[model samples]
Target: MLILTHTLYLNRPEGEIPIAIRIYRPEPKDGCWACTFEIDWPEGTKTMSGAGLDALQALVISLQMIGIQIYTSTYHHDGALRAYDNEEGYGFPIARNVRDLLVGADKIYL
Candidate 1:
């Protein structure tokens, strides 16, 4: 079942794109929750996921992975004008900001 959903905007050279992040429920694994985040672009879509002890951590980890993609995609489009470095936490914060909305169906803790 779907636990929660969030959206983030990534700055690409072509323009801005909305990245949809989602979490699914499957009980739990090793006491951690599972989540999957997807980045959809005009070219295609890429998926990344993570498991965490709680909902927020799961969301954060998944977001971090998407952040890496955002960084790489931005770099691919225009390396010189990219916003933040991969080491600087990439688009994770950008994704996490969606938490302010807290629009999940379950205990997402987002």
Candidate 2:
């Protein structure tokens, strides 16, 4: 089951490109929840997964892996979906508190 979907814009030499990110619902297995994140790139589709204690953790670990890949690769940090001119820059507004979800050092599940 799909849990979430996001469209990330990438800036290329020619123009901006849209990339698809899909996250699936976590499933319980072996004392943990397994989650999947799919990235639909122009070349092909790539899927990465991770396991955690709960649904949110699963999503976090899964997304962290994906985020690392995005930041390191050529497809990241170049485009903006909604235009804004601010020194602070654009930020995602989360309705819920995410302080508890933060993991430091080796705590991130690979």
Candidate 3:
């Protein structure tokens, strides 16, 4: 799997959450092209939570609408990038095919 990254900075709010996103892309030649979205928080922030997975799950739903089969990594205590005291986490997973994986009803929590 060849991994690539695309980062995004947000200056506005989406829904009731004030979140920023970073999108990472997998190598195009691979069977599937995958992406990761991360949330950015500012200094002194202490109550922002659940945005990452929620965003990821939402993305999966959106991808499924178009036909994308994707894979998400499992949740590892040590795998979280922006670690919190069980309040938040990070996941990096691959989508085997862009459209096929998104057709399931299971939640991909990584």
Candidate 4:
């Protein structure tokens, strides 16, 4: 089963909102990835966890397709939903922790 812990609520421009995130660590087997992530949510809020394989896979693939780089251990690239090609000399790597998730590599604009 997956566990969701260490939840924190933040006041954003969107008003008081609940944001929960989990770090997914995947293991490759039979060309499919498997792993668990640490989820964080509000202490008193109710959220769904560990639903179904189809849904989870869909969510993960969606996240990846949008360039949200999911890391295995915060140090290595488990895999990317988007393809990164370096056609220029600007050496931009995807391992820069959330960089690829939020902003495309610096070389993207170069």
Most lDDT-accurate candidate: 2
lDDT of each: 0.53, 0.60, 0.30, 0.35
Q: Write the per-residue lDDT of candidate 3 for residues 1-110, one digit (tens) a residue.
A: 21233222223234222333344332222333333334343442222111122445544533332121113322121232222223332233334553233212232552
Better of 3 and 4 by TM-score: 4
Worst 10 residues of 1 by lDDT: 101-110
Could you say which candidate leads in TM-score?
Answer: 2
Clashes of 1: 0
lDDT of 2 by residue, 24-91 (tens): 99889789898988877778889888789998888777876665555444543333331122322112
Worst 10 residues of 2 by lDDT: 87-96
Per-model TM against the reference: 0.47, 0.63, 0.20, 0.24
Candidate 1, residue 8: the lDDT equals 52
Which scores better on lDDT, 1 or 3?
A: 1
Residue-by-residue lDDT tens digits, candidate 1, 1-110: 77766555556668766656555653366767767666565567666667788877776777656554654465334533222334222234325444342222211432
Instruction: Sort the candidates on TM-score, descending order.
Output: 2, 1, 4, 3
Q: TM-score for candidate 1, please give it.
A: 0.47
